[model samples]
Target: MFRLAALFLALSPATAFACGQPVCLVDPDSLSLTKIITFEGERAGAGPGHNIDDVLPLQGATFGEHFAGQSVGARGPHDEVSGDAFAPLTMMAGRAGQNLSLVHFSGNTVLNGYGSAGFPKRDAQGEGAIAVLFDQDQSALAFDLRGGEDGAALVHFYRRDGSFIGPVPVQPTGEFAVAFLRSDGHADIAGFVLTNTDPQGLALDSLRFGKPPDMS
Candidate 1:
């Protein structure tokens, strides 16, 4: 009788042991923490030639030290605005100490499009590089990039502990493009450094933060 029972259990369907399974399948796309916003909801201004910088706090993100009392339309040479010249930027819904800063390069922190009245012009300033730092750990980040006339722009992401994540290349184009990055199963995206070969440098707009909509 014992031998007969053992043979019956061994021949049972695999579903009989489903409760003892050690692994469960998970969808990777469901685990993603990033999303891209093309700013389609917001107006792109009258036309490509018209640039607007007065718009702020769009989609919960702020530019430069504007929230910290910096005036809008402020322009300075790369040397003057680089480093700790401006206070770190913060998001409206971000944590108390969570902030973002621009380092080692100068250009308008807020510009709607490529060619505004006071937009920086292409110069012989050599290759320009900017470091964007986030004070708190984030799983995703994105921004609109434009005005690269010389060569492609490269962005390198880093972990919260300052470890390298990877590099993304942005081709020089006449129109604005979106560059988005996210960590895989890790919320360690601390910051990124962008270097551009364009003589006119690069302009960033419509900065986005937070997780993807589906993840919410």
Candidate 2:
């Protein structure tokens, strides 16, 4: 306990994720949420401006196997997805895997095997993409969105139990929440964020979740 406290103290106030900032949100149903982790280029040691569209099975990432508890998973061009530390959370195995639950896309999209430092700007490419995260069971759940400078980034949601949510709009910043899984069971989901109105539509940071109802 002392060592952990000391580590926290030793960390700079600017330390990513630990800065105690609230995550941005986009849920009209008022889904409860807490920021379980924050993306930091320094911790990942990959620094700022890393490639958000790298191919799956990325090598030498800072997030080894998982972040918080949910493993990192993203779908790429070849019907393949990779997770943190090169784990293939591919869709060929029924969009379910030992490390992943399901994958989705509104268009040809990919998930970031590891998190990055910034959100998208006004002219970024890559449209119609979303991310979903969870464990083998329904215990863990969540995903990410890249904020934009134009209008609110709205998305059409698909839930784990094959339900739908949204036309939800996430503001450029501050504690956004939406549901993809069952509200009471597993919040599994795949969402189709509309095509970027601006160039930098959805460049994202590490979308964090998992831990439990209290976000502990």
Candidate 3:
């Protein structure tokens, strides 16, 4: 019986798990979502600007664009961006809403195993972290991330009232990787913070939020 159990465990797919916490699935496509933010559209300035607060409260299936033309050094903090209240999806810098930058990538830039033109980068002060708030409460969340050459990052879950839940580490080979986290039980996932240690910088794109297929 012991050997049979061990064999079953070995044959099972690897997953990041913890007691009373969410599970990190290896594939983002495993979860079906109703909406996705691609971050592609118009901008206020010719180059990367600071304190981008114009685009928010996105309506319908409309896709939001990032600020363009700013130099890499001039990238500043981003204001809170969100979808409609019905299916609320908001993204900020820190838990307390600190400032972060939205970067425009040109040339050969790839994230989550695919080419990316622009996306939000981690805040330098926050130590490569971005906080996301889900007003509607979600059972699952997924996004594309690009860590430094070393490739290391984590997803910290939280409740609606700003209570800590648990964390899942994401270590993908190469520069681009995708991360997906789904609650083990109900739709209690209120928010999550993604952090990376890449000194070269961290990038995020293609954020998806919705109920998991397996959940009732």
Candidate 4:
């Protein structure tokens, strides 16, 4: 018997997800949702000129067989352009002696990884990508987002049981926010967001989610 845990961290301008592998869910419209696990908030201009940044958890989901899906995000063709988004929503198997490596996303552009060491607009050809990586034993998870100034980037941590640990802070903090996980032992989900609205900084508002209950 497999277990499923679905979580979505979202904003009016951002959205995200996470899962085990094989199966997954989607909630692209999170700005106008109303529910107990969901709330509303906004930022001046921290998103991609229009979209917000979000994280999610796909339950009972598999990538192949042996390994479960840990994280997902957009990959880029260059370190400047945004790539298509993907995540591990179900459980997938890994090679006999190998682990799941190299999460990928593509579309108009192709991207592999993400970082804040340098600006994609002024540095590398292909921009970096955001991702959630599950540890080897699948006991814990980590979030990584790049493109901010200085070393003050964005990161997060969580327990396999779907408990919130808190946001990971970087130096010289730029803009940032936080979201929570919503699960019901099913294979669907909705996003919840808490944003920061400080000038050239991060602001967090109330918690929010979607309507009609999507998780199964």
- For each candidate in turn, the TM-score is 0.43, 0.36, 0.56, 0.22
Better of 1 and 4 by TM-score: 1
Question: What C-alpha lDDT do the candidate models reach, one value each?
Answer: 0.38, 0.30, 0.44, 0.25
lDDT of 3 at 72: 18
Top-down lDDT ranking: 3, 1, 2, 4
Model 1: pairs clashing at backbone N, Cα or C within 3 Å: none
lDDT of 4 by residue, 40-110 (tens): 12121222221212222223111121113233222222212122112432222222211111222211111
Candidate 2 achieves a global lDDT of: 0.30
Candidate with maximal lDDT: 3
Candidate 4: which stretches are off by over 4 Å?
1-129, 135-151, 173-216
Q: What is the total number of backbone clashes in candidate 3?
A: 7
Which 10-residue span in candidate 4 carries the lowest summed lDDT?
Answer: 190-199
Off by over 4 Å in 1: 1-127, 212-216
Give the per-residue lDDT digits (tens) of candidate 1, residues 1-216: 775555334323342234332111122222232433334444332222222233223434332211222222212312111221122332121111111222222233323222112232223122233445555555545565655564566665555444456666666533454434342335565555555555454555545555544422
Clashes (backbone N, CA, C under 3 Å), per candidate, total 0, 18, 7, 61
Name the better of 2 and 3 by lDDT: 3
